[model samples]
Target chain A: MADPFLLAATALVALALGLGLARFLRGPRALDRVVAFDGLTIVSVAAIALAGLVTGRAIYLDVALVYALLSFLGVIVAARYLEGGEQ
Target chain B: MSGVLDILGGLLMVGGAAFLALGGLGLWRMPDTYTRIQAGTKATTLGTLLTLAGIGMIEPGWALKLALIVLFLMFTNPLSSQVMARAAHRAGVPLTPQSRGDALADDEGRAAE
Candidate 1:
Protein backbone atom coordinates (compact mmCIF):
# COMPACT_ATOMS: atom_id res chain seq x y z
CA MET A 1 0.00 0.00 0.00
CA ALA A 2 1.27 3.40 -0.94
CA ASP A 3 0.24 4.73 2.41
CA PRO A 4 3.21 5.91 4.29
CA PHE A 5 0.82 8.13 6.18
CA LEU A 6 -0.96 5.20 7.68
CA LEU A 7 2.28 3.43 8.40
CA ALA A 8 3.74 6.40 10.15
CA ALA A 9 0.54 7.00 12.04
CA THR A 10 0.38 3.41 13.13
CA ALA A 11 3.93 3.55 14.39
CA LEU A 12 3.07 6.52 16.51
CA VAL A 13 -0.08 4.87 17.73
CA ALA A 14 1.84 1.79 18.74
CA LEU A 15 4.30 3.92 20.61
CA ALA A 16 1.50 5.63 22.47
CA LEU A 17 -0.12 2.32 23.23
CA GLY A 18 3.15 1.04 24.53
CA LEU A 19 3.33 4.02 26.79
CA GLY A 20 -0.22 3.36 27.93
CA LEU A 21 0.67 -0.17 28.80
CA ALA A 22 3.64 1.03 30.77
CA ARG A 23 1.43 3.43 32.67
CA PHE A 24 -1.08 0.72 33.35
CA LEU A 25 1.57 -1.63 34.62
CA ARG A 26 3.71 0.67 36.72
CA GLY A 27 1.37 3.50 37.53
CA PRO A 28 1.58 4.66 41.13
CA ARG A 29 -2.17 5.18 41.30
CA ALA A 30 -5.46 4.88 39.47
CA LEU A 31 -5.26 8.38 38.10
CA ASP A 32 -2.00 7.61 36.33
CA ARG A 33 -3.70 4.89 34.35
CA VAL A 34 -6.49 7.31 33.56
CA VAL A 35 -4.06 9.87 32.28
CA ALA A 36 -2.52 7.27 30.01
CA PHE A 37 -5.97 6.39 28.74
CA ASP A 38 -6.47 9.99 27.79
CA GLY A 39 -3.29 9.85 25.80
CA LEU A 40 -4.55 6.71 24.08
CA THR A 41 -7.71 8.50 23.03
CA ILE A 42 -5.71 11.24 21.40
CA VAL A 43 -3.51 8.72 19.65
CA SER A 44 -6.53 6.80 18.42
CA VAL A 45 -7.88 9.91 16.80
CA ALA A 46 -4.69 10.50 14.93
CA ALA A 47 -4.41 6.87 13.95
CA ILE A 48 -7.92 6.68 12.58
CA ALA A 49 -7.46 9.82 10.54
CA LEU A 50 -4.22 8.53 9.14
CA ALA A 51 -5.89 5.27 8.29
CA GLY A 52 -8.44 7.19 6.30
CA LEU A 53 -5.67 8.96 4.52
CA VAL A 54 -4.08 5.67 3.65
CA THR A 55 -7.32 4.24 2.38
CA GLY A 56 -8.32 7.33 0.47
CA ARG A 57 -11.57 7.33 2.34
CA ALA A 58 -12.71 10.56 3.93
CA ILE A 59 -14.90 8.62 6.33
CA TYR A 60 -12.14 7.81 8.79
CA LEU A 61 -11.48 11.48 9.30
CA ASP A 62 -15.03 11.98 10.47
CA VAL A 63 -14.67 9.06 12.83
CA ALA A 64 -11.54 10.58 14.28
CA LEU A 65 -13.27 13.92 14.67
CA VAL A 66 -16.29 12.45 16.41
CA TYR A 67 -14.24 10.11 18.58
CA ALA A 68 -12.16 12.97 19.92
CA LEU A 69 -15.25 14.67 21.29
CA LEU A 70 -16.80 11.51 22.62
CA SER A 71 -13.66 10.39 24.42
CA PHE A 72 -13.23 13.81 25.96
CA LEU A 73 -16.78 13.72 27.26
CA GLY A 74 -16.27 10.24 28.58
CA VAL A 75 -13.22 11.37 30.51
CA ILE A 76 -15.17 14.23 32.07
CA VAL A 77 -18.01 11.98 33.14
CA ALA A 78 -15.58 9.52 34.62
CA ALA A 79 -13.81 12.32 36.41
CA ARG A 80 -17.06 13.50 37.99
CA TYR A 81 -17.75 10.03 39.27
CA LEU A 82 -14.25 9.78 40.61
CA GLU A 83 -14.29 13.14 42.34
CA GLY A 84 -17.64 12.58 44.06
CA GLY A 85 -17.10 8.94 44.87
CA GLU A 86 -15.61 9.65 48.27
CA GLN A 87 -18.75 11.43 49.33
CA MET B 1 7.36 21.92 -6.12
CA SER B 2 4.94 20.12 -3.84
CA GLY B 3 7.80 17.89 -2.72
CA VAL B 4 9.10 20.50 -0.35
CA LEU B 5 5.67 20.91 1.18
CA ASP B 6 5.41 17.19 1.60
CA ILE B 7 8.80 17.03 3.24
CA LEU B 8 7.89 19.82 5.63
CA GLY B 9 4.55 18.30 6.42
CA GLY B 10 6.12 14.90 7.00
CA LEU B 11 8.77 16.39 9.21
CA LEU B 12 6.21 18.24 11.26
CA MET B 13 4.07 15.19 11.71
CA VAL B 14 6.97 12.89 12.52
CA GLY B 15 8.53 15.37 14.86
CA GLY B 16 5.22 15.57 16.62
CA ALA B 17 5.23 11.84 16.92
CA ALA B 18 8.65 11.98 18.56
CA PHE B 19 7.35 14.54 21.00
CA LEU B 20 4.48 12.26 21.79
CA ALA B 21 6.95 9.51 22.53
CA LEU B 22 8.93 11.76 24.79
CA GLY B 23 5.78 12.80 26.63
CA GLY B 24 4.84 9.22 27.14
CA LEU B 25 8.29 8.55 28.54
CA GLY B 26 7.84 11.45 30.86
CA LEU B 27 4.55 10.01 32.00
CA TRP B 28 6.19 6.74 32.87
CA ARG B 29 9.21 8.38 34.46
CA MET B 30 7.47 10.98 36.58
CA PRO B 31 6.86 9.83 40.12
CA ASP B 32 3.47 11.40 40.75
CA THR B 33 0.07 11.61 39.16
CA TYR B 34 0.07 15.39 38.85
CA THR B 35 3.46 15.43 37.19
CA ARG B 36 2.51 12.62 34.84
CA ILE B 37 -0.57 14.51 33.78
CA GLN B 38 1.48 17.57 33.16
CA ALA B 39 3.92 15.68 30.99
CA GLY B 40 1.20 13.93 29.04
CA THR B 41 -0.87 17.05 28.62
CA LYS B 42 1.85 19.37 27.42
CA ALA B 43 3.69 17.11 25.01
CA THR B 44 0.79 15.08 23.67
CA THR B 45 -1.30 18.15 23.01
CA LEU B 46 1.35 19.83 20.94
CA GLY B 47 2.31 16.58 19.27
CA THR B 48 -1.24 15.67 18.33
CA LEU B 49 -1.91 19.13 17.00
CA LEU B 50 1.19 19.04 14.87
CA THR B 51 0.32 15.59 13.54
CA LEU B 52 -3.19 16.72 12.68
CA ALA B 53 -1.95 19.82 10.93
CA GLY B 54 0.57 17.79 8.99
CA ILE B 55 -2.16 15.48 7.78
CA GLY B 56 -4.19 18.48 6.73
CA MET B 57 -1.25 19.80 4.78
CA ILE B 58 -0.77 16.58 2.86
CA GLU B 59 -4.40 15.81 2.31
CA PRO B 60 -6.46 18.82 1.40
CA GLY B 61 -9.65 16.85 1.97
CA TRP B 62 -8.57 16.32 5.53
CA ALA B 63 -8.57 20.04 6.23
CA LEU B 64 -12.05 20.11 7.69
CA LYS B 65 -11.46 16.91 9.52
CA LEU B 66 -8.25 18.17 11.06
CA ALA B 67 -9.88 21.46 11.87
CA LEU B 68 -12.73 19.74 13.64
CA ILE B 69 -10.42 17.45 15.58
CA VAL B 70 -8.24 20.36 16.56
CA LEU B 71 -11.23 22.39 17.67
CA PHE B 72 -12.61 19.67 19.90
CA LEU B 73 -9.14 19.03 21.32
CA MET B 74 -8.61 22.68 22.18
CA PHE B 75 -11.79 22.71 24.20
CA THR B 76 -11.60 19.29 25.76
CA ASN B 77 -7.93 18.60 26.46
CA PRO B 78 -7.54 21.17 29.19
CA LEU B 79 -10.94 20.41 30.64
CA SER B 80 -10.12 16.73 30.75
CA SER B 81 -6.86 17.46 32.48
CA GLN B 82 -8.75 19.54 35.01
CA VAL B 83 -11.22 16.78 35.58
CA MET B 84 -8.49 14.22 36.10
CA ALA B 85 -6.61 16.53 38.41
CA ARG B 86 -9.72 17.16 40.47
CA ALA B 87 -10.39 13.47 40.67
CA ALA B 88 -6.86 12.75 41.74
CA HIS B 89 -7.16 15.33 44.46
CA ARG B 90 -10.50 14.01 45.67
CA ALA B 91 -9.23 10.45 45.74
CA GLY B 92 -6.65 11.65 48.25
CA VAL B 93 -3.69 10.83 46.10
CA PRO B 94 -0.55 11.77 47.95
CA LEU B 95 1.24 14.72 46.53
CA THR B 96 4.98 14.76 46.05
CA PRO B 97 6.77 15.16 49.40
CA GLN B 98 8.12 18.54 48.47
CA SER B 99 4.90 20.19 47.31
CA ARG B 100 3.57 23.57 48.25
CA GLY B 101 -0.01 24.49 49.15
CA ASP B 102 -2.70 22.75 47.13
CA ALA B 103 -5.60 25.05 46.35
CA LEU B 104 -8.14 22.29 46.20
CA ALA B 105 -7.11 21.02 49.60
CA ASP B 106 -7.35 24.49 51.07
CA ASP B 107 -10.78 25.03 49.60
CA GLU B 108 -12.06 21.71 50.86
CA GLY B 109 -10.59 22.36 54.30
CA ARG B 110 -12.31 25.74 54.45
CA ALA B 111 -15.54 24.22 53.19
CA ALA B 112 -15.48 21.64 55.94
CA GLU B 113 -14.72 24.31 58.53
Candidate 2:
Protein backbone atom coordinates (compact mmCIF):
# COMPACT_ATOMS: atom_id res chain seq x y z
CA MET A 1 0.00 0.00 0.00
CA ALA A 2 1.17 3.51 -0.73
CA ASP A 3 1.88 5.48 2.42
CA PRO A 4 -0.38 8.50 2.70
CA PHE A 5 2.06 10.31 4.96
CA LEU A 6 4.87 10.09 2.44
CA LEU A 7 2.57 11.22 -0.32
CA ALA A 8 1.62 14.31 1.64
CA ALA A 9 5.24 14.98 2.37
CA THR A 10 6.13 14.87 -1.28
CA ALA A 11 3.31 17.22 -2.12
CA LEU A 12 4.52 19.66 0.51
CA VAL A 13 8.02 19.52 -0.94
CA ALA A 14 6.65 20.27 -4.36
CA LEU A 15 4.96 23.32 -2.91
CA ALA A 16 8.28 24.41 -1.47
CA LEU A 17 9.88 24.05 -4.89
CA GLY A 18 7.31 26.40 -6.32
CA LEU A 19 7.97 28.99 -3.66
CA GLY A 20 11.69 28.83 -4.32
CA LEU A 21 11.09 29.38 -7.99
CA ALA A 22 9.09 32.50 -7.26
CA ARG A 23 11.99 33.95 -5.31
CA PHE A 24 14.42 33.01 -8.06
CA LEU A 25 12.46 34.88 -10.66
CA ARG A 26 11.70 37.98 -8.62
CA GLY A 27 14.80 38.51 -6.54
CA PRO A 28 16.25 42.00 -6.95
CA ARG A 29 19.94 41.13 -6.83
CA ALA A 30 21.90 38.42 -8.60
CA LEU A 31 23.03 36.87 -5.31
CA ASP A 32 19.42 36.73 -4.13
CA ARG A 33 18.58 34.62 -7.13
CA VAL A 34 21.61 32.45 -6.47
CA VAL A 35 20.46 31.82 -2.91
CA ALA A 36 17.03 30.88 -4.18
CA PHE A 37 18.60 28.54 -6.71
CA ASP A 38 20.60 26.82 -4.00
CA GLY A 39 17.48 26.43 -1.91
CA LEU A 40 15.66 24.85 -4.83
CA THR A 41 18.43 22.28 -5.29
CA ILE A 42 18.39 21.26 -1.66
CA VAL A 43 14.62 20.80 -1.75
CA SER A 44 14.93 18.75 -4.93
CA VAL A 45 17.39 16.42 -3.23
CA ALA A 46 14.92 15.80 -0.44
CA ALA A 47 12.19 15.10 -2.95
CA ILE A 48 14.39 12.60 -4.80
CA ALA A 49 15.24 10.72 -1.62
CA LEU A 50 11.57 10.56 -0.67
CA ALA A 51 10.72 9.26 -4.13
CA GLY A 52 13.12 6.40 -3.50
CA LEU A 53 11.23 5.56 -0.33
CA VAL A 54 7.85 5.68 -2.05
CA THR A 55 8.89 3.52 -5.02
CA GLY A 56 10.89 0.86 -3.15
CA ARG A 57 13.93 1.60 -5.25
CA ALA A 58 17.52 2.13 -4.15
CA ILE A 59 18.71 3.56 -7.44
CA TYR A 60 16.93 6.84 -6.81
CA LEU A 61 19.02 7.35 -3.70
CA ASP A 62 22.16 7.17 -5.79
CA VAL A 63 20.72 9.73 -8.13
CA ALA A 64 20.05 12.01 -5.18
CA LEU A 65 23.67 11.74 -4.08
CA VAL A 66 25.07 12.66 -7.47
CA TYR A 67 22.61 15.49 -7.89
CA ALA A 68 23.51 16.94 -4.53
CA LEU A 69 27.21 16.89 -5.44
CA LEU A 70 26.58 18.67 -8.72
CA SER A 71 24.39 21.29 -7.04
CA PHE A 72 27.10 22.03 -4.50
CA LEU A 73 29.65 22.54 -7.24
CA GLY A 74 27.28 24.77 -9.16
CA VAL A 75 26.69 27.02 -6.16
CA ILE A 76 30.41 27.32 -5.50
CA VAL A 77 31.10 28.26 -9.10
CA ALA A 78 28.32 30.84 -9.05
CA ALA A 79 29.65 32.31 -5.84
CA ARG A 80 33.15 32.52 -7.28
CA TYR A 81 31.87 34.29 -10.34
CA LEU A 82 29.93 36.78 -8.21
CA GLU A 83 33.00 37.48 -6.12
CA GLY A 84 35.14 37.91 -9.20
CA GLY A 85 37.54 35.47 -7.59
CA GLU A 86 39.00 34.46 -10.97
CA GLN A 87 39.54 36.33 -14.22
CA MET B 1 8.12 -4.99 14.75
CA SER B 2 8.08 -4.26 11.05
CA GLY B 3 4.89 -2.28 11.35
CA VAL B 4 6.44 -0.16 14.09
CA LEU B 5 9.39 0.67 11.87
CA ASP B 6 7.15 1.68 9.01
CA ILE B 7 5.26 4.11 11.19
CA LEU B 8 8.44 5.65 12.53
CA GLY B 9 9.95 6.07 9.10
CA GLY B 10 6.82 7.76 7.84
CA LEU B 11 6.83 10.22 10.69
CA LEU B 12 10.41 11.20 9.99
CA MET B 13 9.64 11.76 6.35
CA VAL B 14 6.75 14.05 7.15
CA GLY B 15 8.79 16.06 9.60
CA GLY B 16 11.63 16.44 7.12
CA ALA B 17 9.29 17.65 4.44
CA ALA B 18 7.82 20.19 6.81
CA PHE B 19 11.24 21.63 7.52
CA LEU B 20 12.07 21.74 3.86
CA ALA B 21 8.96 23.78 3.25
CA LEU B 22 9.82 26.09 6.11
CA GLY B 23 13.19 26.79 4.53
CA GLY B 24 11.48 27.70 1.31
CA LEU B 25 9.22 30.11 3.16
CA GLY B 26 12.23 31.75 4.71
CA LEU B 27 13.90 32.08 1.35
CA TRP B 28 10.85 33.85 0.01
CA ARG B 29 10.34 36.18 2.97
CA MET B 30 13.75 37.02 4.36
CA PRO B 31 14.97 40.61 4.05
CA ASP B 32 18.39 40.12 2.52
CA THR B 33 20.62 37.72 0.69
CA TYR B 34 22.58 36.65 3.79
CA THR B 35 19.47 35.92 5.81
CA ARG B 36 18.01 33.91 2.98
CA ILE B 37 21.18 31.86 2.72
CA GLN B 38 21.16 31.28 6.46
CA ALA B 39 17.60 30.03 6.44
CA GLY B 40 18.05 27.89 3.36
CA THR B 41 21.24 26.21 4.53
CA LYS B 42 20.31 25.38 8.10
CA ALA B 43 16.75 24.23 7.50
CA THR B 44 17.44 22.24 4.33
CA THR B 45 20.45 20.45 5.78
CA LEU B 46 18.46 19.16 8.71
CA GLY B 47 15.49 18.44 6.51
CA THR B 48 17.49 16.35 4.01
CA LEU B 49 19.25 14.48 6.78
CA LEU B 50 15.98 13.55 8.40
CA THR B 51 14.56 12.40 5.09
CA LEU B 52 17.59 10.21 4.42
CA ALA B 53 17.37 8.71 7.88
CA GLY B 54 13.72 7.91 7.27
CA ILE B 55 14.59 6.14 4.04
CA GLY B 56 17.30 4.18 5.78
CA MET B 57 14.85 2.97 8.37
CA ILE B 58 12.41 1.86 5.71
CA GLU B 59 15.01 -0.04 3.72
CA PRO B 60 17.71 -1.44 5.95
CA GLY B 61 19.91 -2.70 3.11
CA TRP B 62 20.32 0.82 1.73
CA ALA B 63 21.40 2.29 5.04
CA LEU B 64 25.13 2.23 4.31
CA LYS B 65 24.92 4.28 1.14
CA LEU B 66 22.30 6.58 2.58
CA ALA B 67 24.59 7.30 5.52
CA LEU B 68 27.32 8.38 3.10
CA ILE B 69 24.98 10.79 1.34
CA VAL B 70 23.96 12.30 4.66
CA LEU B 71 27.58 12.74 5.66
CA PHE B 72 28.47 14.44 2.41
CA LEU B 73 25.49 16.77 2.68
CA MET B 74 26.34 17.81 6.22
CA PHE B 75 29.83 18.77 5.09
CA THR B 76 28.98 20.56 1.88
CA ASN B 77 25.73 22.42 2.55
CA PRO B 78 27.05 24.83 5.15
CA LEU B 79 30.34 25.27 3.34
CA SER B 80 28.53 26.30 0.19
CA SER B 81 26.29 28.71 2.07
CA GLN B 82 29.28 30.30 3.73
CA VAL B 83 30.94 30.78 0.38
CA MET B 84 27.81 32.37 -1.02
CA ALA B 85 27.47 34.79 1.87
CA ARG B 86 31.08 35.85 1.69
CA ALA B 87 30.88 36.32 -2.02
CA ALA B 88 27.72 38.38 -1.76
CA HIS B 89 29.30 40.59 0.83
CA ARG B 90 32.40 41.11 -1.29
CA ALA B 91 30.26 41.82 -4.31
CA GLY B 92 28.60 44.69 -2.40
CA VAL B 93 25.15 43.20 -2.13
CA PRO B 94 23.38 45.58 0.23
CA LEU B 95 22.23 44.39 3.62
CA THR B 96 18.85 45.09 5.11
CA PRO B 97 18.70 48.57 6.54
CA GLN B 98 18.10 47.34 10.05
CA SER B 99 21.23 45.23 10.10
CA ARG B 100 23.38 46.32 13.04
CA GLY B 101 26.94 45.72 11.98
CA ASP B 102 29.38 44.56 9.36
CA ALA B 103 32.16 42.52 10.87
CA LEU B 104 33.58 41.65 7.49
CA ALA B 105 33.95 45.32 6.68
CA ASP B 106 35.85 45.83 9.92
CA ASP B 107 38.11 42.95 9.05
CA GLU B 108 38.76 44.39 5.60
CA GLY B 109 39.56 47.80 7.07
CA ARG B 110 42.05 46.20 9.46
CA ALA B 111 43.64 44.26 6.63
CA ALA B 112 44.08 47.37 4.51
CA GLU B 113 46.48 48.84 7.07
Candidate 3:
Protein backbone atom coordinates (compact mmCIF):
# COMPACT_ATOMS: atom_id res chain seq x y z
CA MET A 1 0.00 0.00 0.00
CA ALA A 2 1.21 3.49 -0.81
CA ASP A 3 1.99 5.39 2.34
CA PRO A 4 -0.26 8.34 3.01
CA PHE A 5 2.70 10.31 4.23
CA LEU A 6 4.41 10.08 0.86
CA LEU A 7 1.28 11.16 -0.92
CA ALA A 8 0.96 14.18 1.35
CA ALA A 9 4.53 15.17 0.67
CA THR A 10 3.90 14.99 -3.04
CA ALA A 11 0.90 17.23 -2.71
CA LEU A 12 2.93 19.83 -0.85
CA VAL A 13 5.67 19.73 -3.44
CA ALA A 14 3.13 20.19 -6.20
CA LEU A 15 1.89 23.29 -4.47
CA ALA A 16 5.43 24.60 -4.33
CA LEU A 17 5.72 23.97 -8.05
CA GLY A 18 2.65 26.05 -8.66
CA LEU A 19 4.25 28.92 -6.80
CA GLY A 20 7.40 28.63 -8.85
CA LEU A 21 5.37 28.63 -12.03
CA ALA A 22 3.68 31.87 -11.16
CA ARG A 23 7.00 33.48 -10.35
CA PHE A 24 8.46 32.41 -13.66
CA LEU A 25 5.68 34.01 -15.61
CA ARG A 26 6.20 37.49 -14.19
CA GLY A 27 9.90 37.54 -13.23
CA PRO A 28 11.28 41.02 -13.66
CA ARG A 29 14.57 39.97 -15.25
CA ALA A 30 16.72 37.15 -16.57
CA LEU A 31 18.02 36.38 -13.11
CA ASP A 32 14.55 36.19 -11.73
CA ARG A 33 13.75 33.74 -14.44
CA VAL A 34 16.80 31.70 -13.49
CA VAL A 35 15.80 31.76 -9.87
CA ALA A 36 12.44 30.47 -10.90
CA PHE A 37 14.17 27.80 -12.95
CA ASP A 38 16.23 26.79 -9.96
CA GLY A 39 13.06 26.53 -8.00
CA LEU A 40 11.80 24.10 -10.63
CA THR A 41 14.77 21.83 -10.16
CA ILE A 42 14.17 21.81 -6.43
CA VAL A 43 10.58 20.92 -7.08
CA SER A 44 11.63 18.08 -9.35
CA VAL A 45 13.80 16.62 -6.64
CA ALA A 46 11.03 16.89 -4.12
CA ALA A 47 8.60 15.16 -6.43
CA ILE A 48 10.94 12.27 -7.01
CA ALA A 49 11.78 11.94 -3.34
CA LEU A 50 8.18 11.95 -2.37
CA ALA A 51 7.51 9.30 -4.95
CA GLY A 52 10.41 7.22 -3.69
CA LEU A 53 9.19 7.50 -0.16
CA VAL A 54 5.74 6.40 -1.12
CA THR A 55 6.90 3.62 -3.38
CA GLY A 56 9.68 2.22 -1.17
CA ARG A 57 12.16 2.20 -4.02
CA ALA A 58 15.78 3.10 -3.51
CA ILE A 59 16.30 3.59 -7.23
CA TYR A 60 14.34 6.80 -7.36
CA LEU A 61 16.68 8.33 -4.81
CA ASP A 62 19.58 7.71 -7.15
CA VAL A 63 17.64 9.41 -9.91
CA ALA A 64 16.99 12.35 -7.65
CA LEU A 65 20.69 12.62 -6.84
CA VAL A 66 21.58 12.68 -10.51
CA TYR A 67 18.92 15.26 -11.18
CA ALA A 68 20.30 17.47 -8.45
CA LEU A 69 23.85 17.27 -9.74
CA LEU A 70 22.89 18.04 -13.31
CA SER A 71 20.59 20.91 -12.45
CA PHE A 72 23.12 22.47 -10.10
CA LEU A 73 25.87 22.27 -12.68
CA GLY A 74 23.57 23.54 -15.38
CA VAL A 75 22.59 26.60 -13.35
CA ILE A 76 26.22 27.34 -12.58
CA VAL A 77 27.20 27.13 -16.22
CA ALA A 78 24.35 29.36 -17.23
CA ALA A 79 25.24 31.81 -14.50
CA ARG A 80 28.85 31.87 -15.60
CA TYR A 81 27.81 32.49 -19.15
CA LEU A 82 25.81 35.45 -17.96
CA GLU A 83 29.00 36.87 -16.40
CA GLY A 84 30.23 37.91 -19.85
CA GLY A 85 32.66 35.22 -21.00
CA GLU A 86 35.62 34.07 -18.84
CA GLN A 87 37.35 36.74 -16.78
CA MET B 1 14.63 3.02 15.32
CA SER B 2 13.64 3.46 11.69
CA GLY B 3 10.08 4.31 12.47
CA VAL B 4 10.97 7.19 14.72
CA LEU B 5 13.46 8.60 12.24
CA ASP B 6 10.99 8.40 9.40
CA ILE B 7 8.40 10.29 11.37
CA LEU B 8 10.89 12.95 12.37
CA GLY B 9 12.08 13.31 8.81
CA GLY B 10 8.55 13.66 7.50
CA LEU B 11 7.78 16.40 9.98
CA LEU B 12 10.95 18.23 9.11
CA MET B 13 10.18 17.92 5.44
CA VAL B 14 6.68 19.24 6.00
CA GLY B 15 7.95 22.13 8.05
CA GLY B 16 10.54 22.92 5.46
CA ALA B 17 7.95 22.85 2.71
CA ALA B 18 5.89 25.26 4.74
CA PHE B 19 8.90 27.53 4.95
CA LEU B 20 9.25 27.30 1.21
CA ALA B 21 5.62 28.23 0.83
CA LEU B 22 6.26 31.20 3.09
CA GLY B 23 9.15 32.18 0.91
CA GLY B 24 6.94 31.94 -2.12
CA LEU B 25 4.48 34.15 -0.34
CA GLY B 26 7.25 36.63 0.31
CA LEU B 27 8.18 36.50 -3.32
CA TRP B 28 4.63 37.31 -4.28
CA ARG B 29 4.20 39.98 -1.63
CA MET B 30 7.57 41.70 -1.63
CA PRO B 31 7.95 44.65 -3.89
CA ASP B 32 11.03 44.80 -6.12
CA THR B 33 13.22 42.08 -7.56
CA TYR B 34 15.90 42.22 -4.88
CA THR B 35 13.60 41.38 -2.05
CA ARG B 36 12.07 38.57 -4.05
CA ILE B 37 15.47 37.04 -4.71
CA GLN B 38 16.27 37.00 -1.02
CA ALA B 39 12.99 35.34 -0.31
CA GLY B 40 13.40 32.65 -2.96
CA THR B 41 16.98 31.81 -2.03
CA LYS B 42 16.53 31.40 1.70
CA ALA B 43 13.21 29.63 1.67
CA THR B 44 14.01 27.19 -1.12
CA THR B 45 17.34 26.21 0.34
CA LEU B 46 15.95 25.23 3.71
CA GLY B 47 12.92 23.60 2.20
CA THR B 48 14.92 21.53 -0.27
CA LEU B 49 17.34 20.39 2.41
CA LEU B 50 14.56 19.14 4.60
CA THR B 51 12.90 17.42 1.69
CA LEU B 52 16.17 15.69 0.80
CA ALA B 53 16.59 14.54 4.39
CA GLY B 54 13.14 13.08 4.39
CA ILE B 55 14.11 11.08 1.34
CA GLY B 56 17.16 9.79 3.15
CA MET B 57 15.08 8.72 6.06
CA ILE B 58 12.57 6.99 3.86
CA GLU B 59 15.13 5.20 1.79
CA PRO B 60 17.56 4.05 4.44
CA GLY B 61 19.85 2.11 2.15
CA TRP B 62 20.26 5.06 -0.15
CA ALA B 63 20.90 7.54 2.61
CA LEU B 64 24.40 8.37 1.42
CA LYS B 65 23.22 9.23 -2.05
CA LEU B 66 20.36 11.30 -0.75
CA ALA B 67 22.72 13.05 1.63
CA LEU B 68 24.96 13.95 -1.28
CA ILE B 69 22.01 15.62 -2.98
CA VAL B 70 21.39 17.64 0.15
CA LEU B 71 25.00 18.81 0.29
CA PHE B 72 24.99 19.70 -3.38
CA LEU B 73 21.87 21.77 -2.92
CA MET B 74 23.48 23.53 0.03
CA PHE B 75 26.40 24.57 -2.07
CA THR B 76 24.78 25.40 -5.38
CA ASN B 77 21.52 26.89 -4.21
CA PRO B 78 23.02 29.87 -2.42
CA LEU B 79 25.78 30.41 -4.94
CA SER B 80 23.35 30.55 -7.83
CA SER B 81 21.00 32.83 -5.95
CA GLN B 82 23.90 35.13 -5.23
CA VAL B 83 25.04 35.02 -8.80
CA MET B 84 21.56 35.74 -10.10
CA ALA B 85 21.34 38.72 -7.80
CA ARG B 86 24.69 39.95 -9.03
CA ALA B 87 23.66 39.55 -12.62
CA ALA B 88 20.51 41.43 -11.87
CA HIS B 89 22.56 44.36 -10.69
CA ARG B 90 25.06 44.23 -13.56
CA ALA B 91 22.20 44.28 -16.02
CA GLY B 92 20.96 47.45 -14.33
CA VAL B 93 17.87 46.17 -12.67
CA PRO B 94 16.78 48.90 -10.30
CA LEU B 95 17.08 48.13 -6.64
CA THR B 96 14.43 49.09 -4.16
CA PRO B 97 15.02 52.76 -3.29
CA GLN B 98 15.65 52.01 0.36
CA SER B 99 17.99 49.09 -0.21
CA ARG B 100 20.73 49.50 2.42
CA GLY B 101 23.64 49.18 0.00
CA ASP B 102 24.57 48.43 -3.57
CA ALA B 103 23.68 44.81 -3.01
CA LEU B 104 24.44 43.82 -6.57
CA ALA B 105 27.73 45.70 -6.53
CA ASP B 106 29.39 42.61 -5.14
CA ASP B 107 30.34 44.51 -2.00
CA GLU B 108 29.91 41.42 0.14
CA GLY B 109 31.24 39.12 -2.53
CA ARG B 110 34.20 41.36 -3.35
CA ALA B 111 37.54 40.02 -2.29
CA ALA B 112 39.94 42.37 -0.47
CA GLU B 113 41.60 44.67 -2.94
Per-candidate alpha-carbon RMSD to the true structure: 3.0, 2.8, 4.6
Best by lDDT: 2
Best by TM-score: 2
lDDT of 2 by residue, B3-111 (tens): 7777787788778888988999899889998899988667888888887777777787888998999898889888899999989877777678889987887867842
Scoring only the A-chain of each prediction against the true A-chain gives TM-scores of: 0.78, 0.88, 0.80
- Please, what is the whole-model Cα lDDT of each candidate in the order they appear? 0.75, 0.84, 0.71
CA lDDT of B7 in candidate 1? 67
Candidates ranked by TM-score: 2, 1, 3
Candidate 2 segments exceeding 4 Å error? A85-87, B110-113
Task: Give the CAPRI rating of model 3.
Answer: acceptable
Instruction: For candidate 1, write residues A1-87 as lDDT tens digits.
Output: 224644665687678768867886776566677787787787777777667767778888878877887888887877777675443
- Give one digit per residue, the lDDT tens place, for model 1 in B66-105: 8878888888888899889878887777678777867777
Predicted structure 3, TM vs. truth: 0.81
- How do the residues A1-87 of candidate 3 rate in per-residue lDDT, one tens digit apiece? 225666566667777777877888887666666777777787678678777766778788789878888987787777666655222
Stretches of candidate 1 exceeding 4 Å from the true structure:
A1-9, A85-87, B106-113
Give each model a TM-score: 0.86, 0.92, 0.81
Tell me which residue pairs clash in candidate 1: none
Q: Which candidate order results from sorting by lDDT in descending order?
A: 2, 1, 3
Enumerate the candidates' DockQ scores in order: 0.54, 0.66, 0.45
TM-score-wise, the better of 2 and 3 is: 2
